[model samples]
Target: MKGILKKVYVIFFISYFVFFTSWFPGLSFFNNSNKVELNDNVKLQAQAPDYWPTTGWRASSPESQGVSPQKLQEMEDYIVSENIGGYIDSLLIVRNGYLVYESYPSHIYDANIRHHIFSCTKVFTSTLIGVALEEGYISGLDDYVLDYFPNRTFDNMDYRKEAITIKDLLTMTSGIAWTDQVDYYQMAFSYNWVQYVLDQPMVHQPGEVWNYNTGGSHLLSAILDRETPNGTLDYAKTRIFDPLNITEYSWNLDRQGIPIGGTLLHLTPRDMAKFGFLYLNNGTWNGTQLIPASWVAEATTSFIDVEFDQSHGSGYGYQWWIYNWLNAYTARGSNQQYIVVIPDLNLVVVSTGNTEYQFIRLLVDFILPSAGFTPLNLVFVISLIVGTISLSILLGFTFFHFKKKRTIKKLRKEFFEETDSNGETFQ
Candidate 1:
């Protein structure tokens, strides 16, 4: 009876240890999970996608691209159940250059539908500036902003306003005393939009302060239009739109026929992913370098401490919102439009929505955590299971052997004591 109890205890202890050690990754020695450190600058080597999404994206199962489908589904469910369904038009996730997950929440929106990306256009504009700089259409960022508008006259002209440079406009440090609250509408209604932006009094010296100025962004488009041989629209079509094969899109122009630099560009969700992918690959597309790689690094790097959305980080780049905290950058627009790039994850996410609600929670809470789960290889899995089982069996046998000897010795002692009480003994 004592031997039976010892065997049961040995089996139970070994079984418990084996069950937990093999099943739970946290407790397992064979866990191969990879934690993504976003700030790591080491880029993944250039591996071509199965096919370029010039025409359309190739869809794949999320799991195939190292993403968890259940978590993605949970993300969708959270959107619907949390009453965030109506606001979002589309959400797209591209990992390892494949469209692993896409969600069009509304019947009106679809894979091919072009949604207005608002201030996401600014990032595009910033990209075009990089291209323009590379092609020599624009000399450099340090060129005086007033040099492009030599023919135009403005109000409150001073040395400070004249001192503004193209870099300042790109960085939103042009010191234009324009406020979105009143001046944005005023500029929209003004007959000469470029003139309206330029006419604003200089409140700070160029590169002196960081201000959220859409007017400064428009001024960039104006400068590009004036500097480019055929105008900014033609330059973009030839250099950017054509290279990426983004055919179905529209760019709203001001009364002067200049493309709205700060807003009003419409694009399909897939095309938006293409742009993010372009940046993710460091401005190279296909085999050709569309925008210089150096410019890509420069454009995304944070230059100023800003007071923008805290969740998105306080750093600001050239028309790009820098989230150094997350080691990601975003082309954020009004109405919650975004093209986010996480280089370390090799992921690009695009979201377009109409309501004022920011859906970054969908990325921060759901999509990001669902990626980079490095499952153990089949060999590793099999070896771990077999090894643990063998170890458990050996440990169980040893435990039972020792337990049996101890039990037998105790039984012999008890027998001797009983015999002595009865004045009898067994050999």
Candidate 2:
């Protein structure tokens, strides 16, 4: 009886560890996306023109942009309706260099707002690493993780700990035992977050297996801060945010004043779209290569097997969640904050809401089918706007002519009536 009870206890313990270590990834529980295929209508189209959004995004009708305008309206109706599982704060869609569709609740969130992005911040951290590598701030991804932190003391440092590389952290293969109980959640509250992260005992050899380690990500930020001239946040401000036109944003810092890269960033949905757009353009923004195209390719390419949702190439990028929809990859956060990029479709979809993972259904079920195959060119939009204005003017002139004729006819009738129903003029 004692032996049986001990075995059962061990099984229960292992089960709890498995369940608790991997935090809620905020995807639908019923996702069976690996076998799903792209809808025929959402097929890949020709390349979209390279248009820079310097000042602001240009607006156009969805239909004009090869996205069904009626479908967007219906999607908006659904967004506004109560059937939406949770509070959907905002949904902004950009396709072929135009802001074809956007929805927001004005009362809950301001028109220009930023909120907690949670784990999506990890992708931004990954971008900073790319910039660091491109600018020679970071030598390479294979460099030893501990080499950057010479001043810091790590407890129980071993051969595996020394073998951990920047890439290992980027890919979450550091083998650091960062589960729910012995993880970043507890480390965040500790007096020294960075030190606490460095002190974590290695559970597996470096580069052996992939496991989500928030502490390992924080170490990346710390390394960026150490290597960069202005520190991680400042480096990001000049390197990523300034170039991308992301003016309004804030990143949480630890007690050591180091930018917490693992989580706690507040960014607007549009700004999130800009980051996605930056990646979709392959590290280039307006022809200037902010991040090396090489790094972008490496970062976006599947480093390990991860099935986040139902679509092809559902693997983990540097920090991005590779989803199955339209072959999209995204910077996703808790509570449905996502900046999904569909390269083949030339689409960037940004959303922030309280509903967990239901937005995927919203996007795949409603948005894709409703979109058109062809790109919506800027020349067409300008011509359409001009045409609309010209048509409105013509209608205005026609209405004026009819109004003038009607007034004259009424006056003549009144005059004839006053003059005893014969030809006569009234005053």
Q: For each candidate, C-alpha RMSD in Å?
A: 11.6, 26.3
Ten residues in sequence with the least summed lDDT for candidate 2? 26-35
Q: lDDT tens string, model 1, 1-427?
A: 4565566556556555655654554455543343233233533323446667777788889999889888898898898888877888888999989999888786669988899998999998998899899988899999998888877789999999989998999999998887787888898899988989988899998998998898989989998898898988888888889999999899999999999899999999899999999888887787888988888888888899875664446688899988765557899888789999877677899999888656777777688778853222343455556656666666677787888889999998998898899998676
lDDT of each: 0.82, 0.75
Residue lDDT tens for model 2, 91-174: 888888788888775346754789788888999899899888878999999999989988778897899999999999999899
lDDT of 1 at 397: 70
Candidate 2 residues lying further than 4 Å off, grouped into runs, are 1-50, 80-82, 180-182, 310-313, 355-357, 372-427
TM-score of 2: 0.73
Q: Model 1 TM-score?
A: 0.77
Assess the local accuracy of residue 16 in candidate 1 as a C-alpha lDDT between 0 and 100. 53
Alpha-carbon error at 14 in model 1, in Å? 33
Specify the highest-lDDT model's number: 1
Q: What is the lDDT of residue 288 in candidate 1?
A: 89
